[model samples]
Target: MALQIGAISQKGGVGKSSIARLIAREYAVAGWDVKIADLDIAQATSTNWKQRREQNGIQPEIAVEPFRTVTQALKHASVYDLVVFDGKPHSNRETLEIAQACNLVVLPTGLSLDDLMPSVLLAHELVEAKIDKAKIVFALCRVGDRDNEIDEAREYVRKAGYQILAGSIPEKTAYRRASDVGKAMTEISFLSLRQRAEEVAQSVIDRLSKEG
Candidate 1:
């Protein structure tokens, strides 16, 4: 079975879909079978993204599906190399299921007070659900130059006692444009912020591949 990494969150508009797409592309480019299960029932971002990719003829890549629940996402746990779930807002039940089904669960958030607060509750819920601390992580996304902002958010999450992934991708126009066109950050030309996003993807894979 391939390693399954879930890009999850308790809030919406926090870049869960974008992170899921890029991570799926990273594994696909590496010749690994990667599947992205969009667990956001209301938005279905990945479902729409898959349609766009097919319409644009994106080839030899991953199989992105719109999965509504944990059972839907885990049906192929023993089949795919990695199944990254983009969980819905407010600690969706699917989040708990995938946490149990995969080796890792990645929670992506921004560095703002509004975008940074709810994660505390979400982390607690995951912990109470019996998600192993070793298999769970927090990834700070849309990290701007606000050093104080970043540091503050980090401090809060750390105080919550959860592991944070090392890389933090800054907000950039290229990422927005790529998502609009259903393309991965690495696939975007003149990616002014490609390194940040790429580093994030790689760091996730490395962390999940490590020896606990």
Candidate 2:
């Protein structure tokens, strides 16, 4: 069976789809047959991004499709080595369903309490629904360059009993520009930015390795 990874968030603009595409691209570059199951039908963010990626003739092509339901997306599990689910913007019944279905559930949030609070709450909900806490992790995104703020946010999540991914994605115009061209954060123009994004991706891979 393919290893399933879910990139979900309680609110939009938290880099959920970005993380989804990052993981898909990371695995694809590593020679794995990967596909992104874009579950956010309303926005189709990842779906549209995939079109641009193909249009630009990006390397390590990744497949992306929009699905109205989680079950519909799961149907392709056997066809690929990995399936990354780009979930809807808000948490609902389907959110828990995705958490339960995935080997790893990544909740991307900003550094502010506004973002962190809801993210931890969602994680709490997932735990309440009997999802393994170990499978659920928080990925910091759109973070500013403040060490103190970053440390505080990490402490907040840790105190809430959830693990934060090793690295955070800092807010940068370059990242947004890269996305505009159907490229992921890791595919940005600057090596520094690319390395930062790769750290998050590698942390995710390490987490999955522990699952085995």
Candidate 3:
């Protein structure tokens, strides 16, 4: 069975798809057969991104397929080394099932009460549903230049007794532009941005690796 990683968030626009694509690309580049299960049926963000990637002739040829159900996606898991699920933007039965299925559940959120509160609440819900707390972690995303904001966000998650990943993605126009063309963060032209993206990608991969 492949290692399943699910990017889940209760609120929208928190970079859940971006994080999933980033990690999936990292694994693909490392010579793993990586496939993404785009569970966001409404928008199919990851599915469309893969289409753009194919049109642009991107390297490593990551596969992405949309599925209406998590169980349907899991059926294809044995063929790939890693399966990254980009779930919808709501807390529902599907989200809970994805959380239960994944080896790691990543909650991406901005560094603000508005974003943090809903995400933290979702984590609590997952825990209450008997999902292993250690299998879940928060990834700070779309952050600004304010160091204090990141620090405060970290402190907030810690206080809530949730594990936050060491990797984070800053708010940058480069990410948006790159995503428009089906490019992952590690594929950007800027060396610094690519390095930051690699850091975040490797952090997640390392966390998953430790589970093995």
Sorted by lDDT, highest first, which candidate order results? Answer: 2, 3, 1
Q: What's the lDDT for all of these models?
A: 0.79, 0.92, 0.91
> Please, what is the TM-score per model?
0.91, 0.98, 0.98
Deviation (Å) of 157 in candidate 1: 1.9
Residue-level lDDT of model 3, residues 109-196, one tens digit each, is 9999999999999999999999999988999999898888899999999999999988578889999999999999889998988887
Would you give me the overall lDDT of model 3? 0.91
Task: Give the Å error, residue 175, model 1.
Answer: 0.8
Distance (Å) between predicted and true CA of 87, model 3? 0.7
Backbone clash pairs for candidate 2 read: none
> Per-residue lDDT tens digits of candidate 1, residues 42-87?
8888888888887887754678777767886678666887787877
> Where's the lowest-lDDT run of ten residues in candidate 2?
89-98
Q: Which regions of candidate 3 fall more than 4 Å away from where they truly are? A: none
Best-fitting candidate, scored by TM-score: 2
Residue pairs with clashing backbones, model 1: 2-81
Alpha-carbon error at 73 in model 1, in Å? 2.1
Give me candidate 2's TM-score against the actual structure.
0.98
